[model samples]
Target chain A: ARPRVGYYFTGKTGSQVLTDKIKKLQVKDFQSIPVVVAENVSVYDAIVTMFLEDVGTLFVVDQGSILVGVLSRKDLLRTSIGKQELSTIPVNIIMTRMPNITMCEREDSLIDVAQKLIEKQIDALPVVKLTEKGIEVIGRITKTNMTKALVSLAIDGLV
Target chain B: ARPRVGYYFTGKTGSQVLTDKIKKLQVKDFQSIPVVVAENVSVYDAIVTMFLEDVGTLFVVDQGSILVGVLSRKDLLRTSIGKQELSTIPVNIIMTRMPNITMCEREDSLIDVAQKLIEKQIDALPVVKLTEKGIEVIGRITKTNMTKALVSLAIDGLV
Candidate 1:
């Protein structure tokens, strides 16, 4: 029979156990609905969609809904202030393209994704699924989600 | 003498210990340097300042460095797409003015600020000090800082 005591023996310190629990958190568990824009959409329309969706970053998709690029508020703001008209400019020309976009899988650890965001200095990452055609944007994870994760841990121990 | 065992006897459980540690994290420990722009600066200059500073939010202040308003990338983007000239329009015309802004103090708990960020649907908060003159911007706390806190907790157990 186990001993009844104030502390339960788990072969790990309290902080170590806590670290393990947080490290196991997966991106799928906290990801948000991904807001996407078609590659051919004008920068103007994309901005409108961002406002309507109330998202900071947008995933750009091709006609087949294949991930092609990523658009951030900074990207749009830069173009908006440029000499060119926003409505006339397509998003593909200004967006961070596929090879340059940082992405993650739904099953990836939230900690790893957080590190990526910090290392890349990006605001968000698309939770993606690789298929026969191309990568599909299944969800979105941003610092907002990370902040919520912290709050949940403090409030509920992430149980 | 304390018992030598796999788990030392503490009144709190592992999760409770972790929760208490995180709940006690202060804004001053994780805050970033605030980037501010004069209220009289043009929207164009503000955008440039945001890019140069590499921050998503900028604090708006008066000549005496008293905080008067807040500017977010979303706020700037909306104004950028407007028909009006960016360079000619001042930031005060579009900023989220005082009394409507969400703020925090350096001594405030990080968890509380994270909750406020989620509740208000805002990305950043100005860490302010109330002086005889008015509010002064001392630091900036954003989702980025919260994310960093989460990462630190995982990597170092916040030790």
Candidate 2:
């Protein structure tokens, strides 16, 4: 018998979000800001931008601004040392492209979110919501916030 | 006000543990397995392990078997050429040690896991879990698995 989709479909709610579960815990939370860059960014400028931002990565986006690939410090450094100089290289030239990016729906459970992280070998996921046009990027999730919550929850969910 | 802890605690399921979460997905699932080695293992052996395992990096574990460091495939090979001879050297001689290691708990949300992988400038995660004895080692998460899972899930979930 086919399993019912209704059984698996979850309601997007605060209680379902792992953050809310851990919100009361007194600890650092993972911020939602994800550094983004244009897909055609020159390698030289991208590296400078990353350094300026003090972040190790940038999200390459389309003109519509949805995430298309990930440009890491290492990726930029590697491409820079190669024959192609910054001007000749596009962000897409060495970027870790998608659908290689791990992503989640706003409705996903923190447990489900964590599972995806471990299973995906990724450090960040772009949270999105379903819309008539397509999957729309919305927020980000971090491991630190999840950990603080998890520790509290593991202690019998003590607040 | 404190919420009720009784209903909040997620109990042990026994099977499909946090370790299982790390191992269940292959790179084919777009996840990466963090490869590892013993502290006493020669850099030569570490190289061989890297090739055989097809992993780009490895973790170094201590006498009690707790993870102590990370060694990229490139770092191991580059440092091994003149830094230490396999005949008398140990991975600990050159491996980047912990708490330098970018690690995550079994319960961390995937969003954070992905961020750590990207931010840490490394390719894998050693999922750890607390046991009655102490914090014990679990399976690895890798970049290959992360990408593979991304490709697979993108197709499976979206298309």
Candidate 3:
């Protein structure tokens, strides 16, 4: 018979220990309530919503809050300062469309999500779950959230 | 005399080898020319600069390019949407001040810079070098840059 082993028993500062902790973390543990906007919303309204929500990124959802697209501050800033009028422009025109957006599920590992964020060079990801209808956005995982987790781990001397 | 040994002699995945390579990198190798703006510039002008530079964060510098403060897209968005007039308002009032800004030197480790970025919850860090005059803004290291490095390593099977 083989003996069962504990993961954390290795040296405290070992990278394996930190890697294990990150892998064990679920996206739901750190994801925040997603700030969403409908695709048809005017760019002006979208800007106001962004400022009001205090979030740099906004998830564009459908009538049932199903993920459709993603909009960022750069998108709005570029559109606003461009020749087009903000009042008449809809977010759908500037948003990164679906089937191209990178997403994560609630059960996704934190390490995997972090990799996606880095690889994609994006600020946030919609934490979604597959359903009978389609993908439903339940929460959001951002660089800030990952940073918070890392900082907490550091402060606790667990990293 | 101690026997000479190599760090990569152990049989590890190419990704692990790349991870080791990244851990040894310094901030200077990854930093890029910083996008900067004057403190007295109007908020509208700053937005234009950001758009032109294609950067979300702009380092606020004084005469001789001395580091003073930092400005982010969120800051501009909030200030512009507020009661204050963007045309008349200056960036100094809204920028994060000197004493509170997190900075790094060229000699700093990449891992340290990454930790600082995560810990401070900021998108970028002003990679500064101490000069006879004062701290000079040599370059900047952003999350996007770091992401690019990570992605490159991953592609090379070194992550």
Candidate 4:
């Protein structure tokens, strides 16, 4: 028979308790609905979509909504300021391509997501899941969402 | 005579060293050029400006560049999605008011700025200075900047 181990109490206090709670929390607990756009969309339209969606970062997907790349406000802003025509430019040109993007699974710990955000120097991560077709973006985890989680935990005195 | 205290090391290692470095860093050390827009500018124009400047947040200023309010991409996105006309809506109406805006001085510690970014549930903070004319917008400190600093420290093995 396998030995059963009960939960252990380490007597965590102060910020340590907060860290523990964050580590215990998963990305699915606070992920928000993702705002995505087609990879071939014009930068101008993408900007409008971003405004309409109330999101700073927009995931660029294919016709089937499969994750392809990611675009941020900075990318669009940089393109707009350039001499190139915004309406003629496609978002795929400036987006961070796949294999270079950092994403988190639903089961990823919030602390790991936060660390990735810092290490990767990005504002948000696309929450994704692996399917037979490949990776599909289901939601997004952002600094704002993490902050809300922290605030809630603080309010509840759990951290 | 005041007693002189000698510097002491607690023998921090690895991540602890990084934490100590981050805690000792100040906002001024990593602040970036601030993007500002006139309060009377239309939401459409503000979005364009944000794109042109490649910034997620824009500090709303008056004729003298005095700090008045703050606007984020989310604000513009929310407003653009609303029923109101985007071209006619002024940013001042949607911006976070001065009293409610959280700002940091140039001398503030980076750790404190990071904490405020979490506690207030905001991404960027305007780095301001108290002058005879009033508060002047000097720069901006953001999560991206903080992450860059952390990454650099990690790369240098200083943290």
Best by TM-score: 1
Which pairs of residues collide in candidate 1? none
- The per-residue C-alpha lDDT of model 2 at residue B19 equals 25
Q: Candidate 1 residues B1-159, lDDT tens each?
A: 877754456677778999999999999999999999999999999999999999999999998999999999999999999999999999999999978999999999999999999999999999999999899999999999999999999999994
lDDT of 2 by residue, B41-135 (tens): 88767777866775556778776767777787546534533424465777888888766766666555554565566666565777776666644
Those runs of model 4 whose alpha carbons end farther than 4 Å from true positions after fitting are: A1-16, B1-122, B127-132, B136-159
Q: What are the TM-scores, per candidate, against the unseen true structure?
A: 0.96, 0.43, 0.70, 0.60
lDDT of each: 0.94, 0.56, 0.75, 0.75
- lDDT of candidate 1 at residue A43, scale 0 to 100: 97
lDDT tens string, model 4, A6-105? 4233443233543444457788888999999998899889988877776779999998778999997766655654567667889999999989999999
Please give the DockQ score of every candidate, comma-separated. Answer: 0.91, 0.07, 0.17, 0.11
Q: What tens-digit string does per-residue lDDT give for candidate 3 at A2-117?
A: 43632222333334433444457678888899999998999889999987887879999888778899998877776765666677988899999878999998888766787888
- Summed backbone clashes in each candidate are 0, 32, 3, 3
Candidate 1, superposed: residue stretches over 4 Å from native: A1-8, B1-8
* Per-residue alpha-carbon lDDT of candidate 1 for residues A7-111, written as tens digits (9 for 90 to 100): 456678778988999999999999999999999999999999999999999999999999999999999999999999899999999999968899999999999
Model 2 off-target regions past 4 Å?
A: A1-31, A44-57, A72-87, A96-100, A130-136, A143-145, A154-159, B1-159
Q: Which stretches of candidate 3 lie over 4 Å from their true place?
A: A1-13, A157-159, B1-33, B38-45, B48-53, B79-121, B139-159
Please tell me which predicted candidate would have the highest lDDT against the true structure.
1
Error of 4 at B71 (Å): 6.4
Residue-by-residue lDDT tens digits, candidate 3, B62-87: 88778899998877776754666677
- Model 1: per-residue Cα lDDT at residue B131: 97
